[model samples]
Target: MDRTSVVEVGGIAQFIREIGPDEGASPPLVVIHGGPDWDHTYLLPGLMPVSLHRHVILFDMRGCGRSTRGLGPDGYQPEFVVEDLSQLIQALGHHTVDLLGFSTGGQVAQLFVESHRRLVRRLILASTTAYAGGDHYLVGWQEYERRLQIRAPRPAWAECRHGEGDRGVRGTVQWALDAAPIAIWDLDRLDEYLALLEGVTFSGEWLGPFREGRLHAWRPTNPEQALRDFVGPILILHGAQDMGFPVQVAQRLHAAVPATSLRVLDQAGHMAHFDQPQAWSSAVLDFLGG
Candidate 1:
């Protein structure tokens, strides 16, 4: 059975949505959505397929979506999010869970695993980077835009690429709108994926700090070294042509953690789950030993 409710966790109301069976041998899979600002809604229909075999949980972190918003700068820390997930899991009666963090969510996952290592049975980091300061990502994005220019190039590409203008939410949204089409490798599925994010809401309060790179203050000084101590197995799943974080970052992560299994889907970009749903789901299910 599917269910949705508002669970008060750590004095903050969190919007939680669960799909699939209530009783099962496997622990529930708690998924963390990307965007320090975006809610859990955009992951729908794409990640919903996993519910067929396992109970899946998705929630809006503190200041996003249906969850409580307007928490000043102090309440929006990454550590607070980690603690929220920990408390939320216990409140839901889950002793342990399989966790999947996508994009920026994956960054939070790293923080989660570091402090709450024992709570996660297995972890999946998708479309994210281990290196907090992504120097290589800039080079990959240039190539991504070059390929995009061949098909459909927006006028804002030049300005957005250099980070020359304002760094406010307006500039951020404009950049995302102009470049979103090319973020997916398969142009055919672009509209289908874009449709999922319609009417989506973003937390400007959170974005203000996030855009300034202050939200990730909890990140380890050396993230690659930190991954070596994780208690559970990890799966680095990414799209070969990802424009945002880039697949090479995933490759570097895979190389750093020799125990991790890496799966890269071709003809897919940042939203690989939407681009290649079957392949993406198969990889995730197989990794969880389903």
Candidate 2:
């Protein structure tokens, strides 16, 4: 695996990692991380299985993780994030490629497919909502709000009152991780996942931007149109027990996208890849026709 940085739209440098196959490959699969605020680290390990089939490209979105910060106000919006993805794809020299998006990343993926349908070959959406509706779509929003209230008395929270500091956002992210229902998967893997998250460094400058770009803060302009318009093959993987994006959202998405196939992992949650690797990987590989 090799890592490189590329400047996308808005001049935000995105941290991209590539896992090349033994034989040089063409048209690599691009994996976009979720959390608008979270990094790509969590998905890195889960992608090891997919590397055997095709080269994999994983990247952190602008203002998150190792990516450059403060692309200004225009860069903080959801539409801009989709534009950044489009720019990154073009810069990488690929006219079209397979796409895998998890959770919030699915929003960007759908938007990209809608606007640039010809650029997406196959699309895989996991543990995500088709639109911004109810608490199901924004599961962590209330949790973050609750944490902010709890930490209001702290100095770090006080520092966030000025609007640009990351204290509140970082604290809220950590709290959400802590509060997430522990998975019943392999205990060792769960421990490793928790440790990786604990070591992540959140960008202070992305705090406000991340919060402002949340699905709850912005209404879904035309999700149905986007879904119905995209013609590429699509696979929807949902966890039966996912608390963040309810299974209904996945079903709804499958219904909207005429060329979609849906698979529900019985024992999985928001992190389906981690909770059910064998099932999740098999479904993806099958969809990819390997």
Candidate 3:
């Protein structure tokens, strides 16, 4: 059975959800969702399939989702997130777990794995990039723009910036609605992705900075070295058609980190799990092993 509760970690109330058994042979898989603005709900059903094989743990980071909020800029730092995950894991009575982070959450996973290497058994980076300042950074975005022009050509909200006028979760939701063309490769499946966002709580405090280009500010001291030094195996799972991080970025990350195994799902966009749930979950299950 799945359970949901709030745990106080690092002096903040963190909302956590768990699926499958707590004392399974394999360690629990702690998943971190992307969007400093997005909570953990969107990954449901799409990510639920993995619960059949191993326990799944999902939670919202500080200032996002149903967790503690309103701390403003200082509370949103990557260090705070890394620290919270560490404390939360210890509080949950686990010595090790398989870690998966999606999009920006993957970035947080990177930091967490590096800071608490002994706590993570395996690392999965889905639809996320290790470094945002590299020269290859623009590849996915440029492709996304090209695809958007061809697919969504002059959408009604074209003139407005994402989350424009609106603040908090609604603003991010608005941005996601506007960026649907590039978010899901199969235009027909766009509604499936949107359906998951229904009633999601967003943090305007976090969204405010995210909208101002703060998402790119996350730069690990030396990601390649950190991944190389990681104690467990790493998986780079991404969408073949992802315009945000692009397949090329995954390729580059794979080449840099010899320990990483790369999996690219076709007909999927940035939200590969939403687009191809079976393939996405199967890949994760296979990687975790029985």
Candidate 4:
């Protein structure tokens, strides 16, 4: 895996990891990570199979991961992030490419495709939804928060209340706040994930803009319009048990898109790629024609 930085559309430098394929391979497939706030590390291993066929490009979106941060209100808006993706594609000199977006990143990708249909060859939306307005979608968010609270660091009340001086409490608290939700399979990965989160400093500037932008709320007032607008082939993969962005959301997205295929993994939850890598990878590979 070769790591480097590239100047993308938003005047922001993007941190990218390029995994080159065997000699004389095809153009790369760009993998977009989820989380309006999360980074690219979690999606890396799951995409190895796609990398086997072509070069794989992974990057940190603005205000997330190893990418340049502190851009104030300009950085967090979903439109700008889509622009950033467009610029990155141009910067890389690719006229058209395969794109795979997970969770929130899928929303960004869908917006991008809606705006620039010619640039996308194949589209993959995994563990994501079309509109965020549905009640089922909020279930996922609530579950995420509940799980987060459980893994949160709790110090003795006396230490915090009396200021008894336990320095470790601060670190633990920070860990709980920034760390991504853990998978049941890998207990040790949480530490590594926490370390990565600590490395990327976040500016609260995007918070206000994010809340105002309402990027989390997906209300496609004109689903028919969106369907009529985009003509690219799309693949929708969702976990049957996903608490965040329930399976029904994926179904809605599939129903709306004119050219789409839907795959629901039975026993998986929110993070299908992490929870069921083999199944996820096989679906992606088959869709992309591996």
What lDDT score is found at residue 290 in candidate 4?
77
Tell me the TM-score of each prediction against the true structure: 0.87, 0.80, 0.88, 0.76
Residue by residue across 86-111, what tens digits does model 1's lDDT show?
A: 99999999889999999888988888
**lDDT of candidate 4 over 41-95, digit per residue (tens):** 7676568756666677888888776787777665467777777888888998888
- Colliding residue pairs in candidate 2: none
Query: Which scores better on lDDT, 1 or 3?
Result: 3
State which candidate, 2 or 4, has the greater TM-score: 2
Q: What overall lDDT, based on C-alpha atoms, would model 2 receive against the true structure?
A: 0.69
lDDT of each: 0.78, 0.69, 0.80, 0.67
Sort by lDDT, top down from the best = 3, 1, 2, 4
- Model 1 weakest lDDT span, ten residues long: 152-161
Instruction: Kindly indicate the candidate among 2 and 3 with the higher lDDT.
Output: 3
Q: Model 4, 184: alpha-carbon shift in Å?
A: 6.5
lDDT of 2 at 240: 81
Worst 10 residues of 4 by lDDT: 152-161
- Per-residue lDDT tens digits for candidate 3, residues 85-175, read 8999999999999999999889988888777999999999999998764435455566565755643333333234343554465566666
RMSD of 1: 4.8
Candidate order by decreasing TM-score: 3, 1, 2, 4
TM-score of 3: 0.88
